[model samples]
Target: MNTTTAATEANVTVATIRDWARRGIIAATKAAGRWVIDTASLAHRIAIGAMKRPAKPARKATFSVETMLAIGGSRWQKNGMDRVYINNWANFLPLEIDQYKTGNISWAAWEGQEIANRQALLLLGSIDKVWFDSADGELHGRFGSGESRIATRQEVWETVVAGIRTAIAAL
Candidate 1:
């Protein structure tokens, strides 16, 4: 079969297959201006590798609720809000989050800030579109500018406290 099909069957890159063939680990032939590999030879090499090095035993992933709590607490301290891992089952969330931030802070710090943003959203009694930033770096609550708004000073404290509790429970 052609290199592309062979690579697909082998679960490796075309470059990897090329490297293996160049190393004389597998045989290949030219077909239609492209390299075609012998499926049987490729299978034998894979079987040999399986017998020699073998595949490492797969392990189950464990999610620690403590880690979630720690993340929430850390965010609360930094952002003056609450945050939770909406869905980071594989722990790749930090990398995913870095795509949105200034890329200077640690993943833990960034995660906390994100949680706090969500907390701040609810606390300020603002709609989903509103964002709040503290002027003095102390007090933070939302204030919507447009006609489509749901922010007010009177209910801000209670809503934020309730939102924090809800966010914590979501973890």
Candidate 2:
């Protein structure tokens, strides 16, 4: 099987597969913008002690936000709530969504956006509607009446932690 496909099937990231290659735990070669791995070697590594298994991060309502950011951005984020919210949302999107070259695409290239938005709704939560009432104060009143089927904030944090553990184990 193809190395990249095998790694993904095994729930291991490409970087981790590469590290295993460099460490002589897996045989791989870059070909056609993809890495091919020897299935036999991978199994051997898993059987022996050369390849360490990944451990899931401890669950917590409030894990280090910086650690979550580091899992992808390589830098800890200490910005305010808005920035953090955006980052969290971005992390949940597909890599293609994050990689969109908005500058080159025309306005008509948004069917993809609709698909992504719908998928995000399922993965995160649906935004039924938001209301802003300016009757009380300058801030007014806000409400989030979305479907409650998606992941909670704590669940999202735990998912991030799990992802980080998977990534670090590969590295």
Candidate 3:
């Protein structure tokens, strides 16, 4: 049968039949400047549904709180913060920041309430020797002590959020 007849009988487009012929999926021959599909081969393929397209591969999830945190941690370290300090801060902050970014909570409330809590202060103090300077209210790395300047509470929170954003963009 000709390509048009095979396509009409199989309930598919002429282009689809032509593609199958080109791919050698269904046996066919050229005659009179046109493809002549073997009626038996076309019938078999239609009956068995072998013409259906293959399944696509599953895609990876691109955005998640954990992935954002990991990216933030790498960015933080790249910015010269100590590894120990970065790890400690990352553990303390994963959930709160995730919540903020996901719009579960307002940024003002998170910065003013959650970040201003005594527990937050203690977490900062814990990493003082490595990154934070409680006396000067600055976050400093081992390498850039001279360039370190005092950072306010809001600036610190902004820094964390910025790192998270930078990480997400990298992904």
Candidate 4:
């Protein structure tokens, strides 16, 4: 059988089948510049693979704020970035109610924010109506309508932790 057919039968990739043939781990021959795998040899290889012990699970890589940030100030953040740069990243992690009066999107106080569905959700706790109170400098929200309770800074940080930063680090 061809490498493709062998790979399907063996429950592996075609590349793996080719590699095995190249390494002489399976009885195969090249005809018309393609690998022809022997059925008996493929069966033998499958049996051997089944007999082998499963490999240990990979160690979970550290991907939290502490592990990925430039600062460890009880937050995931950095300072000294220019206004344009900060605003750009702040837009990356947008808020449902953005009322930055100064147009200065805070970026240094966003710790543990990626877990929230939206920045407002972080403070509002999964609500329908949400808004930012610029005068009080807080987020506001309620169950379905009418009057909003302020989402205080004490409830969550003012700044936003850009998810792109952590996402890149993961790669």
Q: Choose the strongest candidate by TM-score.
A: 2
Residue runs of model 4 more than 4 Å from their true location after superposition: 54-171
Give one digit per residue, the lDDT tens place, for model 1 in 47-122.
8867897565543322233434442422222455433321212121111112225633221111122233333333
lDDT of 4 by residue, 30-87 (tens): 6534567999999999999878956435444333333423222122123632111121
| lDDT tens per residue, model 3, 25-116 | 89998653356799898988887774575533544434443453454333233454323234433322221221335544232112222342
| Candidates ranked, most accurate by lDDT first | 3, 4, 1, 2
| Ten contiguous residues with the weakest lDDT in model 1 | 88-97
lDDT (C-alpha) at residue 33 in model 3 = 35
Candidate lDDT scores, in order, read 0.41, 0.40, 0.47, 0.44
Point out where model 2 deviates above 4 Å: 49-63, 69-171
Report residue 145 deviation for candidate 4 (angstroms). 50
**Predicted structure with the largest lDDT when compared to the true one:** 3
The superposed Cα distance between candidate 1 and the true structure at residue 90, in angstroms, equals 26
Off by over 4 Å in 1: 58-171
Q: Which residue pairs show collisions in model 2?
A: none
Better of 3 and 4 by lDDT: 3
Model 3, residue 1: displacement in angstroms? Answer: 0.7
Clashing pairs in 4: 139-151
